[model samples]
Target chain A: MEGMAIRLQGLRKSFGETTAVAGVDLEIRDGEFFSMLGPSGSGKTTVLRMIAGFEAPSGGRIELAGQEVTGLAPFERDVHTVFQDYALFPHMTVEQNVAYGLKVRKVPKAERLVRARKALAEVRLEGFGKRRPSQLSGGQRQRVALARALVGRPRVLLLDEPLGALDLKLREQMQVELKALQREVGITFVFVTHDQEEALTMSDRIAVFHQGRIEQVGTPAEVYERPATPFVASFVGTSNLLEGESAHRIVGTPGTYSIRPEKIRVLKESAEADQPEHATAVGTVAEVVYLGDATRFLVDLDAGGRLTALQQNLETSSEDVAAYRGTRVRLQWHRRHAVAVPVPD
Target chain B: MALITRTAGALHRRPRLRLTLLLTAPLLWLAVLYLGSLSVLFVSAFWTTNSFTSEVVKVWSTDNFHELFTVPVFRQVILRSIGVALAVTALCAVIAFPLAFYTARVAKPKWRPLLVVAILTPLWASYLVKVYAWRLILSEGGLADWMLKPFGLGGPGYGLTAAVLTLTYLWLPYMILPIHTALEQLPANLLDASADLGAKGWRTFRSVVLPMVLPSVAAGSVFTFSLSLGDYITVQIVGGKTQLIGNLVYSNIELNLPMAAALGTVPVVVIVLYLLAMRRTGALSSL
Candidate 1:
């Protein structure tokens, strides 16, 4: 089960003049919740299609379960996909939608019902069998789509932004619910989404895509805390992008350096004793925003532009906006958290 | 905020209600003109016709319906009309389905416009002129005979067969466009979703594509069937003695308006029956 669930090697797709999915390569482990995260037109969906056998690659190969499935038809492959729109057969009831694949495979009546019942119950939708998809809410319909995909017992489940169409509250709930369901079933789920929070929340590992290529691939913490490229850094979360350079690999002004919003510390005149790693910056407070538990301040650097810093509002002194915003307050941070990356030209 | 103010606001809504009803005047006229007249005609079907006077006498009885079955020739005409309508509908659906699917699903951006223009060009030409052209082509020593001479598919051309061909050709665009509309509006992701769920070519069509477009198929076919049943020009011009309800109505209209109205109820009844049958197929209606 630790074998490669999907091994996409240099896959590419082009539509007439536009290259939708340029050369992309990645390997997903079996039973892992892997997410392909990218912006719109970043080829995440195209890669998902190639894995599902819906779109053939212009170049490169895909292997699933140790079998070269690059040229196989969609039915010939061992993959199931839940589309973003749910694509729950609108005309079909939840039970019939879940039973479609079994009927196609000519499964026996008793076995089909038993498997469908089990799959539906796994998604916590046991009593929704007789309801049509239109009668079901968006989240329920999405679960029906999940149940349909899982009922087939495919080797890999391709989810193309399955939570994108739900309300905010429902989407967040379903994300946790879907992650739990994935763990319960132990099926390799290849999820596609542009939502960075979603990928960070649920994925065991994520491949950040840009221009149809893997910009970076790692665990959530690795991708977030140690982004390898400018695109990955900015795509993961908000960062203060500053032009800096690296001399002898030590990182100085000339190339872009990412200072995480939380890494900045609001100081009085001297740095705290514990924050004595390196690369401290002194700036005056340009703007401050109070966000309940934490207050954020933008500090204008003497070298160039403004940098945002997030400070926890632990004391009543932090609430003094007149002392922070538009005031000459010093801010400093450690060097390890400020990683430098070359800007993409 | 008070009850008197609420009552005053409700009283001011009367003119808007009057305007809304006034806007429905044309629709009311159409309903009264079509439905009211058809209902009267259907009631007349229960009355018997006098054998000697050959006039329809208004009496409360089902004698005319019973007498309609007593003669084998009347049943033969009825069957011929039904057979022709059903044949036209089936032929149109078969010919249009693939072409419509290709236009909607697979055609390139530039090619779609060209294909649609080609399909619509035939409709822009005079419908009667098309019938006339077919009438000339189907006659003895006509274009069809000359064209088929090399292929050996000729014996001066078949009669009712030629009429069916002409009617199918005439209504082909009507059948194609609606099916094209339905197919075009069909979500591409649905087919993609079906494919990802282990449905191959035929299975995808059976499970996903066919059920979604069943309404369009029903609507387009009913239009072709009923239109062919009511069309006197194509069948009369191309067919010499193909005895359809259209020709039956045409023969009585000049000398006997009442008999023409009576015969008109045949195709109307057939269309109503077709629509009623279509509604039972579990497909949603957009009409």
Candidate 2:
């Protein structure tokens, strides 16, 4: 069995009257890329900070590598964090910044410099060590921050939205690079991010957080396919929620159900949906949004609700899909695609 | 009114003319009133004083500078002034760093501006009044002695130590302002990142906090050092027989104007050299 890298029991933090992380219990396996995915103010960052020992949990026990580390300072713990802003020391050269951890640990100067350079090379930043952080571009600075955190080789690396500042293209590129680096290093990576796509693409397992509590903990595919709660269904991706009359009329149920937009296919009103395992609804296409690679059709069903269906733009252009608005259409998906999610209080 | 409108239109059309007009007054003030007098001082420093009738003499000579360098009393006073300036700057830094850190980083945001105003309140008081207050405090059996009596200790009576103490108090606001600004602007995440990198509090302070705020410290020291170097009134009031370069310059103004100007150039030269050293540390860019 894989060892647990980090474990938290009843982790809670409150700033005065407002609670940031109400209660969290999690066990992150060693060498796994675990993510806490949530929207801003959902307490994901507070949880990450508490695990890193930058913040003291108001009521909880934190264990790192099976040793209780509750109330220990960040320096005393066996973890490191990559700040969102990069937080590269402006005064030091890139090498010195990466070597800071080793220097603090009383590592020999020559050995630390060698390890710093090796870490930099791992991030593809060789020979850039003499440059100051201000001299490097945004993406380069990000790699330097990554290298600096990795050079210490801590048991668990806590990253707090480290790519939040980068542009879309750079963020996508670094996401891949970070995933590969985590796999190569074989250290537990606990990534906290509000970007659902980032968490979905990089994390081995994800814990969806809402209002300071985990909504669900599962693999990315599981979280995406079978969301545990209504919040998770909407937050992780676009979900066409059906409830009450619509749920009864279309889904043949009287509870909340989440259907992924991509699962439903839009067809002409007269198109046959004869399969017994498929759920079909007749609706009018109220709006059509052209998304380059895909087209989103917002359908106002006659059954008393709106459903969104995504269709690939393989044989259609923007003008062609734009002409689909206000047309009568039929949306069909497999019956099992509509997952019943627990309604929130 | 038409002429005014035409002139404004013309100025708007020509950016260079507009900029020149905007800068003319300040440029004139800086060049003529400031640099003009400074050049006059430099030229007069090389001239000598007539000894026979004690009349004005503008003949160019290095006699004053020669005496300023050779004379034992002038050398002693010059060294003493520099020593006091350095001591005051060091003490101001040691005292102001924690106070400024508290005001900027530790204090609640609502109280920051009020704390800054409190630090600046002393500057509104008359300089002579402040010096005289220090004079009273440093007097035998005064506030200093009264405060130290419980510890079985007494104050260092009026002298160079008194001058350094008074100057440190006087120039503390100058030191605190820049350091406070720098500390306020320092990102909190850097501290967190430092700690996350396995640096303890003092290590983070030395590696992250100190280097980042050093330029501001140098900026503040400029104020404290130069001001302390040129101060003579505080010495006269509370310094108790201490003679600084400013005292020599003030005493020689009537009898030996050239000698006084030469004496004045010493602090200016020292300040220039100090600025060059600070610039090497990249302090000027932050300033």
In terms of TM-score, which candidate is strongest? Answer: 2
Model 1 spans with C-alpha error above 4 angstroms: A245-256, A270-275, A303-305, A315-319, A340-345, B1-21, B39-63, B155-158, B253-260, B282-284
Cα-based lDDT at residue A24, candidate 1 = 84
Candidate 2 lDDT, tens digit per residue, A134-250? 999999999999899999899999899999999999999999999999989998999999999999999999999998999899999999999999899999999679989988988
lDDT tens per residue, model 2, B1-287: 99999999999899999999899999999999999998899999988878776665889898888998899999999999999999999999999999999999999999999999999999999999999999999999999999999999999999989999999999999999999999999998899999999899999999999999999999999899999997999999988888999999999898888899999999999999999988987778877
Q: What's the DockQ for every one of the candidates?
A: 0.68, 0.90
Clashes of each: 6, 0
Spell out the clash pairs found in candidate 1.
A244-A254, A244-A255, A245-A252, A245-A253, A245-A254, A245-A255
> Tens digit of lDDT per residue, candidate 1, span A41-125?
9999999988888788889989998899999988888899998888888877889899988888889989988998889998899
> Share of real interface contacts recovered by each model?
0.82, 0.95
Task: Give the Cα lDDT of each candidate.
Answer: 0.82, 0.93
lDDT of 1 by residue, B1-287 (tens): 69989866766788877566667888788789988888787776665556566677677775545544676866787788888888988999999999999998899867887898899899899998999888788888988888888997873454678778899999999889888888888998888777777778899899889988888888888789889888877777777777787787788555544555667787887888888888776422744
What DockQ does candidate 2 have relative to the true complex? 0.90
